[model samples]
Structure formats: C-alpha cells, structure tokens
Target: MVGAEESGRLVTVGRRFEVVRNRPLLTLAVGHMTVDMYAGLLPMMYPLLAGKFALDLKTVGMVALAYGAGSSLSQPLFGWLADRHGTRYIGLALSWTAITFALLGFVPNFAVLVALAALSGIGSGAYHPMGALNASAVISEARRNSAMSIYTTGGTLGIATGPLIGVLTLGAFGLHGTIFMLIPGLLIAVVLLFEMRAIALRPRRTGGSPRLVPPPVPIGPISVVVGVMMLRAWSVFGLQAFIPIWYASMGYEPSFYGLLATTLVLANVIGAIGAGHLADRFGRRILIVGSTILSVPALLLFAQFPGSIAFVTAAAIGLLAASTTPLLLVTAQQLMVGRAGMASGLVLGLGFVMGAIGVPILGAVGDAHGIQNAMRLLALIAAASASVAAFLPSEELVRQFANRNSNALPAASLPTASS
Candidate 1:
C-alpha cells in the first residue's frame, strides 16, 4: 500500500509526463491554425477590397506586400529573442494579432487597412518561431518530421478554411464580418497561455546550461534550401493572390472562385501530412526534388485549364508544390542544431518575403500581360526551384554536418593545448 506522500508524488509525475504528451502539441496546432487563418482571409478579401476602393490589381497587391513585409521581415528578431529568452509572450502575440486583424474591416481608408494588416502580421511574426520552437521541443527527435507535419497541417487547414469563412461572412455582411474572425483567435490564445504556464511549471530534468551562442550553420546547403523555398514561395503566393481575380475576370462568382481557392489550400494539408511521413521513410531531398519537378507540369496544366478542370489542376499544384513546406522547414532546423528558432526564422521569413515581393510582380504581370500568362510564369519558377532542390545535402550528410558543428567551439573560444 502506498502512503499519502507517495500517492502525491505519483500524481505529480503523471502530470509532468503529460506535459510532454499530445495535449501541448494540440494546443500549439490550434494556435497555429488561428493565426494562419488571417493570412488566408487576405487573398479572399482582395476582391471585396478592390470593389470598395476602386483599386487596380497592383494596388490590391500592396496589401499583401505590407502584411508579408511585416510578418516575414520581423521573424528573425522574434526568433532571436525566443532563443535567448523563453517564449513567454506567445499568447500575448496571438491576442494582439486577433485584435488588430479584427479592426481591418472597420478601417476608414485603404491606407488604414494596409496599416492594420501590417500590425496584425507583426503579431503573427512573433507567434511563428515561438510556436515552432515549442512544437519541436515537445516531441522526440525520431518523430519530429511527423510532428512538424501535424503542426504545419494545422496552419494549412486554417488557410484552407479561411476562404470559406471569408466568402460566407463577407458575402452576407460585407466588411463588418471580419469582426467575427477574432473569436477563434482569442479562444485559442487563452488555451495556449494556459498550456504554456502548465509546461513551465513542470520540473526540468536537465540542469545543464544552454549555450549562449550556437555553432555556425552550413552556408552552402542552407543557401540551396533557401533558394528552393524562395522560388516555390513565388509560385504558391502568386497562385493564392491571383487565382480569385483571374477567375473573376473570367466571369465566375465569388462562391465558385472562393471554393476553388479553398480546395487548392486543402490539398496542401493532405500533401504536407503525407510528405512528412514519406520523408521519414524515403528521404527529404528526394521528396523535395520530386515534388517541385512534378509541380512544373501541374502548374502548367492549371494555367492551361479553367472551370471544373481547373479545380483538379489546382489540387495537383497544391499537392506537388506546397507539400515541400514541412520538409524544407525540417531540413533547415536540422542544419542548425541549437539555433532552431533562428533557422526557422530564416527559412520561413526569407521564403515569405520572397512570396510577398512576388505578389506585386505577379500583379504587374497580370496587368501588363494577362493572369494566365503570369501563372505560366509560375510554372517556370517551379522548375527553377526543382533545380535548386537537387543540390540539397542528404539526411545523412546533414546530420553529420550539424553534429560536428554543434560539438566544435569557435577558434577564439577553444582551449589552448598548453592549458
């Protein structure tokens, strides 16, 4: 028979063990979903915004630029802060995003709308690295790829659902419907805060001090990964930003185009989850290369077709193109051992910035040429990304390189033989 003290200890141990379980992952996944839903809403709302403001495609693209610049450019700083300190403010960041994004509909002018979008993006920027860091930390190494896929799926699913929500709300109430977007974000923020506090209260098993400065990352391999990510982002963002306008010009209604956009993003969810498991089994580089290569043809088909056939091609584009996201993320993290946050920031931030920049360029192309021609350009970009992905180091090489760098000290920090 156990004494009262023993029973209490058992309960504490059980609670501590629970912190490393699926609950925290679920909480973070939900938070990711809530944050990324806003990203999805922007593209869906572009038609409405343009109609109201009498804006051209280029002007509408500026909204994406502002939001993307804020979110993508600020990631490294937030990541550095998370690495140095703990991610204590993650929930606060979510709350801030929810409030700012909710105000988007209430803005008096286009400039004000752009500004609010940027502000909301800043909050999203803060949440990403923090959420990613925790997502990786809560799971074991062997399961990281799968775990990241699940986490990323949450965001992808949110993006998928966002268009539907936008069509429903904006269709009925117009701009004022954006106010309802705040509800899920706020609720998820509370859940994340509680989960974070619980995890913090759990006892630490290791007393070792964390390294203040991480080892140098492999520049050659990381650069290749980033290049691939950038080109892919260029294509994906172009599609997301332009698909609605492209279809609208072809005389399709909001309901039809919106569902098409949602279908495209939904395929990303399926691809991400499947790719994660496949990467764990086959290899990351192969998956990256094959997916990007296949995406070239899929993108071409998407541009060549419209209407019912376009949906099938869109799903193909989503699966073959956006599926590499989690794999690239995991590859970046593996290239830098102790600097997961920084690695995540660099990969996600740079990729997103490229996407942001591409939106305006694609819009310009759509203006000068045509939207279909601009989409064909995306196919060319995907081919380039496939070529870049071919140069990425294998999993075995990456592990060896990361381990070596992590264990070695800088020349200045190394101990003298005489000592």
Candidate 2:
C-alpha cells in the first residue's frame, strides 16, 4: 500500500516537472502567435483600406511595404542588441505592437494609417529575434527542428486566425473593431513578462565565460539560404497581399475571400509543423528543394483556375511554399553556431524585406498587366527559389561545420548550436 502511494506521488512529480520544463517555450510561442496575428490582419484589411482611401493597387502595396520594411529592416539591429543585453524587453515589445496596431483602424487619413502600420511593425521587429532566441535557448539540441516548428507554428496559427478576425470585426463593426484586438496582445504580453522572468533567473544551458565578440559568419552558405528565402517570401507575401483583391474583383464577398485566405494560412501552419518533423528525420535540404519546386505548380494552378478550384490550389501553395520556413530558420541557426540571434534576424529580416519589396513590384505588374499575371510571376519566383535551394548544404554538413566553429570559439562567446 505504501509502495503504491509512493509510485503515485512520483508520477505526479514527473508530470509537474515536464510542465515546468515546457512553460517557457509555450509562453514564447504564444507571444510569437500574438505578434504575428497583427501581421496577418494587414492583408485582410487591405481591400477595405483601398476602398476607404480610394487607392490603387500600387499605392495599397505601399502599406505592406511600409509595414514590412519597418519590421524586416530593424530585426538585425534588435537581434544584435538582444544578444548583447539578453532578451529583457520582449514583453514590452509585444505591448508596443498591440498598442500601435490597435490604433490602425482609427486613423483618419491614408498617410496616418501608413505611418501607424510602420510603427506597429517596429514593435513586431523587436519581439521576433528576442522571442526566437529564447525559443532556441529553451529547447534541447536534438529537438531543435521540431521545437522551432512548434514556435513557428504559433505565429503561423495566429496569422491563420487573423483573416477570420478581420472578416468578423470589419464586417460587423467596421474599422473600430480593431480596438478589441488589443485585449489579447496585452494579456499575452503580461503572461510572457511573468513567465520569462523565471526563465531569466535560471542558469543558461551554454557553459563557459561569455565572449564579447562572435565569430565570423559563413557568408557563402548564408547568402544562398537568404537568396532562396527571399524568393520564397516574395511568392508567399505576394500571394497573401493580392488574394483578397483578386477575389473581390471576381465579385466574391468579403467573408468568402477571407475564409479562403484563412484556409491558405492554416494550410501553412499544418505544413510547417509536418515539415519540421520530416526535416528532423529525413533532411532539411531535400524538403526545402522539393517543397519549393512543388510550389511552382501549385501557384500556377491557383493563378490559372478561379472559383472553387482556387481553394485547392491555394492550400497546395500554402502547404508547399511556407513549409520550409522552420527548416530554413533551423538551418541558419545551425550554420551561425554562437550567433543564433543574429543569424535568425539576418535570415528572417532579409527574407521579409524582399517579400515587402516584391509586393510593390508585383502590384505594379498587376497595375500594368493584371493580377492574374502577377500571380503567374510568383510561380516563376518559386521556380527561382527552387534553383537557389538546390545549392544549400545538407543538414549533416551544416552540423559538422557548426561543430567545428564551436570548437574554435572561446567558451560561451556565443551559445553553441548543439548546446
């Protein structure tokens, strides 16, 4: 009887231990979701913004460009700061984004809306690297790919929900519905601040005295990865920016188009999580190359077919195109060894900036030619991304290189990828 009681207590203790261990990752993941939810809102709101402001496609694309530039351009700087000082301001960053984004609906003029979007983007920029760094720091080495997928999926899921929320709020309450969005971000921000404090006090997984300077980055491989990522982002972001407008032009109602956008993003979430596990077991390069190649056909199909058939193609595009995100993130972190934060920022920021820049270019094409042609161009971009992805090193090579660099660096100069 006593033995049975002891066993029960042990099981309970083990369960408690597991939950405590996972708490930080969960908190950061939720934070990622909340921050990205704001990003998702923009595309859904674009059609409304256009109608309200009497803007053309190119001008509407500028709104995305403004947000993307602010978010993407500032990431590396914020990442560098996070590495030096530690991620102390993550909650504050989330709160800032929440406040700025909530005000987006209330803006009286196009200029004010654009300016506020950029301001909101800065807050997202601040949160990303800090959140990503902490997410990486919390997990075990063997589980990095899977763990990152979970983290990335949080953001993806938030993005998936964004269109739904936008359709509901904007449909029912007009623009003022944005005010309600502030609640979740603020609540999550508070939770992160409390949870992360405990994590901050814990001993770091990386041993040895901290180094003041990080080692040199592998520019060649990183450049290749960035190139592929940029092309992929261009396709993904371009599709996201234009999907609603295209559907609207076809006479689809806001609810139908919004649901389609949600389906696409939700498919991305599924693909990201599944690909992460696959990459962990199989290899990153194969999945990256394969997915990019497959996305070309998916994009072409979506562009060629409209109506009911479009949903199927959009899901395929989402599944194939965005699936590589977590894989690329893990690969970049593995390559950079000690400078995970900086590498993450560089990869994510540059890719996003390219996507941002591509939106306006694609919009110009749409203005001059047609939106369908612009989408076909995304297929070409995906083909280009596949070509670049072919050049990426295998996961085994990246691991060996990361290991070699870690051996050369002074202890704790940067967190080792393996650590």
Alpha-carbon lDDT, every model = 0.82, 0.84
The lowest-lDDT stretch of 10 consecutive residues in candidate 1 is 410-419
How many residue pairs clash (N, CA or C atoms closer than 3 angstroms) in each of the candidate models, in the order given?
Answer: 0, 1
Model 1 segments beyond 4 Å from truth? 1-21, 200-211, 408-419
244-304 per-residue lDDT for model 2 (tens digits)? 8999988999888888888889898888878877776788899899999898889999999
Q: Evaluate model 2: give its lDDT.
A: 0.84
lDDT of 1 by residue, 1-419 (tens): 56988999997676434423677677778888889999888887888889889988888899998888888898888877766566765888889888998888888899998999889989888888777777777766666777788788888888888888999888998988999988988998888787787542121222365444557878999999889888898899889999889999899998899999999999998888788777767878888888999999999999988899989999988787655767888788878766777777888888888999999898988889988899899999988998898898988998897678657634333211110
List TM-scores for all candidates, in order: 0.89, 0.91
| Cα-based lDDT at residue 321, candidate 1 | 65
In order, what is each prediction's RMSD in angstroms? 7.3, 4.7
Deviation from truth (RMSD, Å), model 1? 7.3
